[model samples]
Target: MAYYPAEVKEAARGLYCKRYSIREISRTLGIPRRTVYHWVDAEAWGDMLSHEGVEDAAQRRLVLLITRDDKTKADLQEIDRLTSALERFQRLREREQAMRGEPCETASAKPEQQDQRGTREKRERKGGDSRSGKRRGRVIKNDVSHLTPEDFKAQLHQHYFAYQRELMQAKHYRNRQILKSRQIGATWYFAQEAFEDACTTGDDQIFLSATRAQAEVFRDYIIQIAQQKFDLELKGNPITLHTAHGPATLRFLSNNSKSAQGYHGHVYIDEFFWIRGFKELHKVATGMAAHKKWRRTLFSTPSAVTHPGYGLWNGDWYNARNKVKRQQFPGFKEMQSGILCPDNTWRKIITLEDAMAGGCDLFDLNDLKLEYGPEEFENLFMCGFVDDTNAVFLLPQLQACGADPAEWADYNPKLPRPFGNKPVWCGYDPSRSRDDASFVVIAPPEKPGGMFRVLERFKWVNKSYLWQVARIREITQRYNVQFMGIDTTGPGIGVYENVRIFYSRATSIHYSVQTKTELVLKGRELVESNRIQWDAADKEVGLAFMMIRQTTTPSGAMTYAANRSESTGHADAAFAILHGVSYEPLARPRGGCRVVIG
Candidate 1:
């Protein structure tokens, strides 16, 4: 063991507290990285680092530099700069406290001015002044009183892409239905639009998604936009903004029909095609915005054609239900550039190509094409819905498995032990074309014939097998993992070997025709029985399951397979889930099946 002086150790600790990487600290202090790690662990440096704020860290560093026997000119300069910064931070804190109506030490020293200010405030309150009138009611946290319509338009014009402007231009229509490619910033744009509308018009904005977590994405985007564009921090769920007109509430809600009953506002439904029980949800959603003043916006990438929203998309539901004479609707091509239909709905289809043409440069077109299969590419990015007739797992049956994970009162992912001593099954499907691998954590039934809930699923791309195993090991520390199933046909074999060393319960699954058949059959049985559930927001799981199709091998035997070539990183989620569910056997051995000769 090499000895490090007290000064050197103190310097390393200071650097660590200053947010330097351990390797960086080690190199700077001329100590071995292992020694620094040991010191950090033994002295609990991480706890100190986390609890120490910026000002405290700077003060500590300044003290350390001041006590040093040998200091450079740069050190003296940094000391002077930090001292000035600390003074400025103190002044800013005092100003903030004064603004918040708290008596600051400096403000208290001047009693005459404080007394005059208090007298004026009291007189204004008693005399029914306009400023005091605005402050008399419930205090709104995010006040946008000074923001003008021109200010909003300026921000929008500067930040929005061309397609977003098109959506904005069509805001006059009462009903707008958009079919868009995945990840073209539709949710973000809608969040911005809703916030602006709520602020300017004082109209309530309601955002709906398949699950509460998904709905919060809208809330997050709104908060981010407000802070970035206007330097305002909005607070509260269903945030109420105090505007020039009045107080406007922004409600973020899941597709729970019961929870969405009474609100009246402009409604935005995100990923409507992927939501289960869409007809019921749509009924509640439409009822909320039944008034002529409220607008309805529905937007999503395409899902399976079997979804109920498909009828609404093709105008089949509209034509069949209405007693009025049936009207001919525009074809898909005619609607691509947007059209106002006879049903009084303005509809548009924006494919990936259209988004690119509209100047969204966020995606690499070639990479996306190479990453997804032809069918997936068309369905997910070209506004084409899945034709699931040949699929082994139909959308309707899989829809039964969609659930809101937020309703699980027992599980909190933020905790260190989210499932706390409850046994969870883990499954891994290794990468096939060095593209993508998937891992899942599934909570099995507490009682016989109960439900299996998928708690978490992760996808890794182009990572080594050791890294995958390390992640599995970390998951074990957080979960009570009783069973782990790993596909050992290819790179999975390496993962299985490493995992089994630490987790004795880890099971190796080698794929053959019979094994694949058994896995798919077991998974299908679970789905058909409605015994499995996953987060409703996760559309990928349903898509992965729908990718599997029945085909014949060279010997004319029926088999199931998904597109798993290099061009398409396919169905890993479905197989990972199957690996976990396969822990439950296809069948218990019957009494008659046992041979006496055995």
Candidate 2:
């Protein structure tokens, strides 16, 4: 532990006993604030210490004199004789005052005694702090005095306090995991914990962050806290404090397995799940801390199950639970049981729900729900884990209504036989840049309210707006297209205008939050209800559908688009189909007659 020099320590004690603040003592001592804190033991050097010590010493001396000194015993006998003589002398003085018409001292003291009793009874009736129901237990209050300055700051946040209490209360765990909702202040809380440990302990501690910017942020916070709260300035490079006990240093580094090499200290891994090569980093960190009293904490808001942190949290428990459930029941949904921490490790999961319930005001749940939509908000803010290996459209769901690519390729769009005399609708999404412009033609059902099927699909790269419009015009004329839904967002506006001039049946859809949302909703509804079918062997089409992913913004806005893979394109094809579904296909084949049942 870092400590102050003898002179500085003396100065700190003097100022502290004089009721000077810790910051004031630190400034006077010209030492690091934390060092001053370590040197000034409040319990040992409180407000009444000197007076109580002097009184105790006098009493002890009196006892020793009575027990071991005959001379002192004789002196005490004389003192008692003098005390009785003084009492008689005082009584004689009072009798003389009464003869002179002066009031007796006893009469003056009676009401004072009555007043003291009345005050005591009144206090008892008031019940002190119990009436307010805010009385804290002595033990709990005592623990606060043990906290370092930075920890005291952390206590101001209730969630952090509760988290620390849980960790401290656990008997068997040295390692801890904090899976928390985003923006819930876990980073700040742990940073304070690390700062306190570095300031108060002789141990060398390492703080790792996901990026250089983040590492600097964590480091800057420590320096700021030291300066603002303790009047300590951490100057010079490689930030080290030379103290009476030893040299204490806090080094911040970027998150990497290599950074952990040849370092021995408590390890703080911030945003552990977001770090690349986290598994390797974890291995290296644990190995470095294996021989020492070094402790490690891995914490993050969850992402995909592919993240190494998720595996650490769920893998063991999932396997064990899976085995037991399979034995009990032949079939069961695969549900992750709970986090199974490693030996001497603790795991805690705190969601936005928990934080809000605990009266945390950092996040508005309704806003986040709208921004992230259900799936993303649930994963990031709800402390819910997701497996995104099959992102968006699952292969099985897509394959249910999928047809063979060979059959789809054999049926030419020029022939009228394949369309089955049904009115065909085309959905168009145009892109002027590197993204491919895609269009899909759908064949409506032969009967009323029947499923729609993909008749033909095509994507054009480096195609001119005029060329795309010509193709739309040609398709409209060849297939006698009933209705065309075209995305009028960005470059699509020009295409929508030109196509409308040639093909009057085309509808321009101005893409906005509501429109895209409705498009995705309608697309999903069509798929789920088995109202739409596509060719299975069309890899580009499948990839486009798979790329459709939704994202939420911090301001509580949502957007949906393809995941954008180099192998395929931005989900223009998927959006086109989504647009096609908006027209609803009229739900009747051409030349079909409706009966008047009523």
TM-score of each: 0.75, 0.41
* Candidate whose lDDT is highest: 1
Error of 2 at 124 (Å): 49
Q: Write the per-residue lDDT of candidate 2 for residues 227-268, one digit (tens) a residue.
A: 665545565323554321234566676654554588777777
| CA-RMSD of model 2 | 30.8
- Supply candidate 1's per-residue lDDT for 160: 80
Off by over 4 Å in 2: 1-161, 164-172, 236-238, 317-342, 392-598
Which sections of candidate 1 miss by over 4 Å?
Answer: 1-139, 322-324, 565-569, 589-598
TM-score of 1: 0.75
For candidate 1, lDDT tens digit of each residue in 1-598? 6986554566667667655567666765567999999999999998987777888777777755544435679778988998998999889988997798764433222434434443444344455357546544222356665566798888776778788888999999999999999999999999999999987777899999998889999999999988888877888776877665567899988877766898999999999999888999999999999999999999999889899999998888889987588888898888888899988999999999999999999998887776667777898899999999879999989988988786663466766677656789988987665546899999998766689999999988778888888899999988889888888877778888899899988888877788889989989999999999999889889998999999878899888889654344578899999998787777645442311100
Give per-residue lDDT, candidate 1, residue 256: 73
Error of 1 at 351 (Å): 1.4
